[model samples]
Target: MDRPLGPVPAHAALEALLPPTALLVPEPAPPWTAGWDERDENDGFRPDWLQVRRLVRELMPTPKSVTRERMAEAEKECGALGLDGLDGGEGDFATLWTTRTGAWLAEEIFEGLTRLCDVMDLEPRLRDFAEEYVRRGMTVEAARAFMLAQ
Candidate 1:
């Protein structure tokens, strides 16, 4: 089959690689409305970022050549985006729910996720899920509900 030529939607890309049951315990969808709230005021960093990384490894249908250690290393390198002090406009909050500390669902994270789909030959699946995800407006709340309802 021919491969998709460009980046896939982030959440769909992630869902395609994770186990079907990953949503059994869905992370609390961060409230994007709370734009630029301080991390200390809101709480600590959001776990959804790292949580996705963990799920990708834990829920693989088959263990590919990639090792857990390698995944960890990937996390170390791309994991923490000093999400503290992102001085972007409120409109930026539309896609990312960031804290005053600056941590958020950045594009780089999604890029990494979609790249994983390409490596795993899951781009077709990602495409399907991406369509659904887009239909739901690409909101985390909708993604959680859709995954759970499945």
Candidate 2:
């Protein structure tokens, strides 16, 4: 992993500006699209509106960004798959957009997310995170969390 070093001052400056971008890759894809697995079901189920709102808010980090649209699509897929007992009432696209999120969940929206990530260039942040975790304001767990977030 080691490479040649630049002068100390330039190295420091480069580190401050950005970490190496090659290492940060999105997490592995998720499994499950639809269909109930009875073994995974629970007896009681209740929706938590507070958690729902918070979770939705978290998804819509950029006030008026495409994430909102993407979320709606993912939700639709989640509903369909979940109602059908696919996830036993719990499902998320997570990193599945790499596949389905709910693959067929929201076809257009899933495609849009790919475009959005391309337009946003998330790989750069990913790369820096891989290069050096501490410099970018993340704990070891937080670094793992970032991968999970993707």
Could you say which candidate leads in TM-score? 1
TM-score of 2: 0.20
Q: Which ten residues in a row have the lowest lDDT in candidate 2?
A: 98-107
| Candidate 1 residue pairs that clash | 37-100, 83-101, 83-102, 83-103, 84-101, 84-102
**Model 2 Cα lDDT, one tens digit per residue, 1-150:** 022222243234334433233213222112223333222134433323223333444654332432646666545644554432122334444332222221122222223333444344344544343335434322333344434434
Question: All candidates' lDDT scores?
Answer: 0.36, 0.34
Model 1 weakest 10-residue run by lDDT? 94-103
lDDT per residue for candidate 1 within 19-82, as digits (tens), equals: 3332322233444433343353457644444444344335332224345554444334433643
Q: Could you tell me the C-alpha RMSD of candidate 1 in Å?
A: 13.5
Top-lDDT candidate index: 1
